[model samples]
Target: MNEFQRISPQQAQALRQQGAVIVDIRDPQSFAAGHIQGSRHLDNHSLHDFIRNADLDAPLIVSCYHGNSSQGAAAYLVGQGFSQVYSLDGGFELWRATYPDDTAQSPAE
Candidate 1:
């Protein structure tokens, strides 16, 4: 089994610009409050669908509230055959603070 790498929010942002797929593992309410722009919410409810539909080789970045949980999520994704999985180091809080303009609230919320 391969381990996922931990990257700073700035590195994650660079990955995003290169078309990495970002997935937020936070609860629905938290995710609805704000998230990285273009990130997909992949909580327990939607994880299965996402896994089934997502390309296995795509660069996948996982983020949680404080970055801790995202490490586990990133590992899981890598185990599921995602070739390039990364855990965002500072998660949503860091991202929000670092690049507020790159964040977006859930429009459907």
Candidate 2:
């Protein structure tokens, strides 16, 4: 069964306001460049730990560079028992363009 929904950046914003967990599947460098405020970087290396610590039932919004990659990531999260999963329709690029003020640049570590 399809376990995730694909939503626009605007819809994502609304979900975020309601406390949805935003997960960026982009590479660390891309994520570091910019991402939705409060989004966690969840690439392959950090995915396991994230899964272990995350609330499976909380709404999860998955995003990639563009929207294409997020669908799979969202589905995987759902397969792992996440009850609510959403793929950002146009991904981070669209989000950044649509809501520039909603983004945050990650400080160099």
Score candidate 1 by lDDT. 0.91
Global Cα RMSD, each model: 1.3, 1.2
lDDT, candidate 1, 14-86, per-residue tens: 9999999999999988989999999999978888899999998888999999899999999888888899999
Which number leads on lDDT?
Answer: 2
Candidates' C-alpha lDDT: 0.91, 0.92
Q: Candidate 1: lDDT of 16?
A: 91
* Candidate 2 TM-score, true structure as reference: 0.95
Q: Which residue pairs overlap in candidate 1's backbone?
A: none
lDDT of 2 at 28: 88
Q: What is the number of backbone collisions in each predicted candidate, taken in the order shown? A: 0, 0
Per-residue C-alpha lDDT of model 2 across residues 47-91, encoded as one tens digit per residue: 999989889888999999889999999989889888999999989
